[model samples]
Target: IAEFNSSRKLIPASNTKLISTGLAIRGLGPSFRFSTRLGYSGYISNGTLHGDLYIIGGGDPTIASGDRMTVKTDSLFAKWTRALRVAGIRKIHGHVIGDGRFFDGPIENDTWSYNDLGTDYGTGGNGLCFNRNIQTFSVSPTTVEGKVNAEVTYPATPWIEFRNCAVTARPGTGDNLYQFNTDLAPVAELRGSLAIDKGQKKESFSNKFGALTCAWEFAKYLEKLGINVTESPADIDPYDNIRYTEAWGKDSTRTGFRYGNMAESPENLTLVYETKSPSLKEIAKVTNSRSDNFYAETLIRMLAKKRTGSANYDSCKVVIIREMDSLGVDMSYGAQIKDGSGLSRHDYIAPEFFCRYLKAMSASPVFKQWLYTVGIAGEGTMAARLQGQSESLKHRIKMKSGSMNGVLCYSGYVMPSPGKPEDDMIIFSIMTNNCPEGGSKVRSFIDGLLMRIAK
Candidate 1:
């Protein structure tokens, strides 16, 4: 390694996903898929579903968002509608419930800063998630100074409300808005102001109720199809009151309040329609390509839930560490991973440990799939990056970029340069924390360093 401080524990930022995604690729394999099921808890009598219409969340990230690779429109609702029709059910008499119990515990990470909680990137992961757990708000400049106008949230969540306190600023001031919301709390507030010159700006904010949103959206779709839904979409929070048994694992005292209402299990639910997400390889492609916090967290928690029967922060870390240890990578080498998204300040990892993990994972059968998901120099999150690199140079490098506040990190593989037969490919890890000059400056420096290393 060019830098001698490899053993020093630093915030790997989004680089944390590299480790988690690698674990997923090797452990879960490339063909693993997340499945969401559409079923009914009660009997289907002639034209009516006597009990709850259950939309069970299997932690599928691509339910509504079209696959990033194929660009196929997600006709999820249409598929469900057809299934319902084939089942001879024309009406749902009971509540349309969203069940996302695959993963348990709180929605938002307890370690995440309050500042990051409301932004789209900080949106927490759950068993049932839809629309990337995001809410879109459009703001317009008001004619009166210091007063901005915000439109109602898109996709229209009637259950949740917004308190717009944003103001209009002078031209050239730019948008300086911040949104605040909690995992189960329905209300949100928009604070700060937008520039008057900026007309009709749309901003994306994260929310805690993805399953609710998904069910709500599907209910609306069913209505359009002349299939009557009696009540609005709702979610049954299984994690509401987790039994405090020691065998359940995790500290019961640290468990946060579970949001939403609780309902009886849909264990005996009859199948109606089912949706399968793109393979894990494709998911890793999107998650790493965009450095998606939601997907990363989901994958990690899913893994934890599968192995430990719990998806809380502590359980996830336990499982991840155990997985690495099983692979002969001693996680005790100064690595502390609190959240999968790397948004929490509680996360810490030594460059040496990360590099060691990468090197070990390089020989995996699904390594190529994992490599292809990360952004190339001119694609995905890196679409506007590596400005001066040749196409060949760009293709030779695949990277996952991470930056938040004073932390910036990049970790991935660098193939041997063209025509350099004897040159060895490199798996590199670099992290810069508390950079006084900011993330861009650190990224520029890292870019310069990579060029020299690639040579």
Candidate 2:
């Protein structure tokens, strides 16, 4: 290594996924699936679910892409209504039984500091996660007023409250403090602000994230999808929103169902729904390719359930450590995987451990098939940096990039290296932590270096 800057045990940031993801693939195999079961307490008769409907969650993480981080009964209600309707059922006159038996851990990682959970970058493990278990809020400046009006993709009724102190500021500095605290989901929070550098007075806002206030939207979406309006639905979210509603009609049907029918026990309704876990490899790619923290957290929790028989991250740590040890990857490098997405700064990993993972994945056929194909400067995360560099460097680089507030890292295979002229496989891991410039700039710089190495 050339003259370096500072040398200490650094926070690997999302690079920790290199360890979690790689080991997850090796420990659980790339083909594993998270299972959710739909069981009935009574029988279906006269087009009505006679007893209660139990939507059991075995930690299926690939629910919704955004705003699903905090699961609202409404989003799930919509799917349930649609599914039940399709299955030749009309009314579910019973309680929506939430069987969270799969995960008995706290909503937030006990190891993670409280400050980070309220920031919205972190996620909670729920039997029901919609829209990727996160909510989105878009703010566009009103053409006339100096203030901006924001809209949630999934509109919530008792609606998610927001205190947008964000004003239309000058270019390069339009930022606001995005924060939320819910009586619901006490262990987690929805945070991050709408920052605009250059845009007209009007901009469309959207994110696949959950807000402490997403209950209103979920209710709205469900009603639209044909769920008979039912007294505004209960706010059963993990935030301070967990309240028991008086059981309707003696619990005749399942109200809070996740809507995914188990392969073994599909819905008893004539119109049952088949909810599938996005392939494990597909979810893995989202993290490696874009370093999606939400997906990473979800997958880690899901895998944690499989590994430790519990969905909580604490138990996940146990499973991850055990599996890592079983994989024969030395613990000398020492890593602490607080969450899958690496949003929690507590995540760490060594460089050689990083490279070892990449090389191992490169050798697996299933991984090779699911791993993302880089366009150099053509598309995806590498597109911007490879604009001029990737042209002559086609097919030479296939890698995953990761970043956090002040870090940047990349690890993957380089098709040809100087050492082996014909066809040599090269795996590299580079991470810079706690920089002032932020990780995006550092990521652009990393892409530039990778393109140069491709030649």
Candidate 3:
């Protein structure tokens, strides 16, 4: 119904997921599923395996995430343990290796701010992701009034050391705790303060070494199941391996070298079991609804790998541009896609692009599935928004919201009336950058505008 500065590019924040998720739905299909495999590199004789046990990653983001749509960690580990027992693997004579070479290059986008790198939402996408690539800690204020106690509460991170530097603040001050650590760092420092009245709370931090963490957790689970593993869990760091570079060099076309091709594994590797992730449609729903950065990044990487034979951020950018062009969405007007999740301050796109993209998606064959993935009233990021509005009005508004320091954006479709057909839907995007107003005020303004539109 309106247009203002629509062609001007601005920071999109998590609204970038709209593009990433759409490309994923179009390129990978709604029914596509990611697979992670458990196999051994050596011969199993009697009751002992002579070589490393491998968890070959397929870049599945939902493994052990404990979401309503995904499996829990302990249950998944138990299933793996049972599979090992059924395979007659009473003992492992070598290390449990996490082979995460499915997706290559830096785990995180280089443009992402360092401050965000340590937080749970800032966690990078990784092959063989487990527990959503997050490490949770239980923190409580101490009796000393100035000190707090914190400890790792999940995935058994024996390899990591935590130094609690958090303090106890006055009542009603709330939790201000933050974790400081680099990617794959063994040490993490917890800094900030928690209100004494808040008691204990759970804080989450990014887990960059997802593959290694997964292997470590599984090895520990096996030990608990009376199965002995000789060596500690280890991960294959693609950046440090000479063979990785050689493999890339060998594949001049960069095709058939990653994702599904397990050429890096030993020829005699024995398949134990394989796990399949929820469909891409389900994953996209979670991504858009929750604004999940990890899921968005992984989906884009998977899309790049499928279309371009490479999974790095650069390849993902290329694939996105090509796909948008195919949809006749002009991105030439100062659109910059730095990362799939829009975690990077470098990502910029015009409001027009979002509307055009939404219109294009609405015309797609999978439009219903894509529409179902978006957040509605009282759901995901939209749960607390439009509070006083009627249920019918609220339900008529479906969109994805994006917010950061001074950025707030909403992009999606608004039904013209209750039970309206798809053709009658109105596509819209509102992007605000460097707004001086508080988030709550900005959100209220946006909500009012959307309410009017819905009516």
C-alpha TM-score for every candidate: 0.90, 0.72, 0.90
- Model number with the top lDDT: 3
lDDT of 1 by residue, 1-455 (tens): 57668899988888888877888877777888888888886787889888778888888877666455432333667778888889988998766777777778888788889878889899886888777888788788986466678765665565565688888888999988888987555678888889888999788888677877777677777877888877556676545421111111123122222233346565777877777888888888778878888889988887887788888878988999898987778987769889887888888988888778877777667777787776777787777667798888878877777777788777777887877653377888888889875566767778888777766
TM-score, structure 1 vs. true: 0.90
Q: In terms of TM-score, which candidate is stronger, 1 or 2?
A: 1
Segments in model 3 whose C-alpha atoms lie over 4 Å from true places: 143-145, 170-173, 239-268, 418-421
Could you tell me how far off, in angstroms, the CA of residue 103 lies in candidate 2 after the best superposition? 3.2
Candidate 1 wrong stretches, greater than 4 Å: 69-74, 143-145, 238-262, 418-423, 437-441
Tally clashes: model 1. Answer: 1
Please list the C-alpha lDDT of all candidates, in the order they appear: 0.76, 0.51, 0.81
What's the lDDT for candidate 3?
A: 0.81
lDDT ranking of the models:
3, 1, 2
lDDT of 3 at 258: 17
Question: For residues 265-350, what per-residue lDDT tens digits would candidate 2 score against the true structure?
Answer: 22342224445565566567666666565566666676676666777767777777676566555555545567766666666665
Weakest lDDT window of 10 consecutive positions for candidate 3: 242-251
Superposed on all Cα atoms, the candidates' RMSDs to the truth, in angstroms, are 6.5, 7.0, 6.9
Candidate 2 residues lying further than 4 Å off, grouped into runs, are 1-8, 40-45, 50-54, 66-88, 95-101, 110-120, 141-148, 155-172, 182-274, 360-378, 392-394, 417-423, 438-452
Error of 1 at 424 (Å): 0.9
